[model samples]
Target: MAAIASSGVKPITGMLRRGLILDLSIALGLGFTFGSAFWYGYHMPRTNARDNFYKKLEEQRAAKAGN
Candidate 1:
């Protein structure tokens, strides 16, 4: 009985095989979006240029204090 049941069981296939292309396309788009967002937020000049901004501000403050 067990052998007959095992023989009757077919391989699992074809449930979600239709939309593979669409799935891959969405994955690629989201991957690029998240990657660029990470790069901009952490590695872009605006984020790293904050030190320069503070230095300029301190310079202006010192000039005003000296005046």
Candidate 2:
């Protein structure tokens, strides 16, 4: 009886450890995905050749305000 209890406990402990590792992997993956998206968005090239619609609107507003 004591041997059976100890044997059952090993599998449960191993499964719990694997679950924690899987959780860490998933969290890191999500964090990296979000972090890369933010880096890409923040690092986009700034050029007048590109038609930035919202930027144009803000510029027009500023021009109007100055006038």
Candidate 3:
């Protein structure tokens, strides 16, 4: 009886540990993927646009100074 109960508990604990690891890996993977997508798709374009605007403004200033 003691051997049977111990055997049963071992498998249950092993399954629980595997399940926890799986859940954590999945959550981290999704977070990294979505975070990368958002950075490249949305944030980068806005940042590039702002940078371009500043460059154009600087060019305009240079042109005015030249005149």
Candidate 4:
């Protein structure tokens, strides 16, 4: 009787550990995907727009100085 009970417990423990690891891996993958999407969709566009604005302003200043 004791031997049978211990055998049952081992399988349950192993299944539980596998389930936990699967859940963690899925969470990590989702976090990386969302972070990349945010960096490309939101942050990069804003940074590019600001840089362009500065470049145009500098060009205008140079034109004014030339005159």
Candidate 5:
């Protein structure tokens, strides 16, 4: 009984499959969109780069003083 069940579940010949090229193309497009968003956020001058740096520096100074 077990052998018969295992044989039924085995992969049949010519049943192998490969990813469609179209699916890969769609994934590449989504990656490009997310990458662009990250690039824009990191490099945009209007973003709070200076404020964030000063905030982190203050934290470090406070930590050093506490220790």
Candidate 6:
């Protein structure tokens, strides 16, 4: 049955093409997310405010021990 075979072939080919497109799109999205995270972390700014806070905590601990 040539007609039946042709009909089956069409749906199979369409599904395979759609699957490939979906896979490629998902891969691109993941790549973008990872790339942005890496870029921001690598270029993060330096701040001394956090360092000062930790230093204050250490000072408090030392004072408590002396008491």
lDDT for every model? Answer: 0.84, 0.77, 0.92, 0.91, 0.77, 0.78
List candidate 4 stretches off by more than 4 Å.
1-11
**Highest TM-score scorer:** 3
**Lowest lDDT 10-residue stretch of candidate 5:** 11-20
> Residue 51 deviation, candidate 6, in Å?
18
Clashing pairs in 2: none
Q: What is the C-alpha lDDT profile of model 2 across 1-67, one tens digit per residue?
A: 8788767455555788899999999999999999888767664543332558678888999999995
Leading candidate by lDDT: 3
Residue 9 lDDT (model 6): 48
Over 1-67, each residue of candidate 6 has an lDDT whose tens digit, in order, gives 7788767445555787899999999999999988878766653432355677888999999999995
Supply the global lDDT for candidate 6. 0.78
Q: Write the per-residue lDDT of candidate 5 for residues 1-67, one digit (tens) a residue.
A: 7788778576565544334566777899999998888878675644678778888999999999995
Quantify how close model 2 is to the true structure by its C-alpha RMSD in Å. 5.9
lDDT of 4 by residue, 1-67 (tens): 8788767455555787899999999999999999999999999999999999999999999999995
Model 6 off-target regions past 4 Å?
A: 2-10, 43-67
Q: Scored by Cα lDDT, where does model 3 land? A: 0.92
Model 3 per-residue lDDT at 62? 95
Candidate 1 vs 4: which has more lDDT: 4
TM-scores, one per candidate: 0.41, 0.47, 0.79, 0.77, 0.36, 0.47
For each candidate, C-alpha RMSD in Å? 6.7, 5.9, 2.9, 2.8, 11.6, 6.3
Q: How well does model 4 score by local distance difference test?
A: 0.91
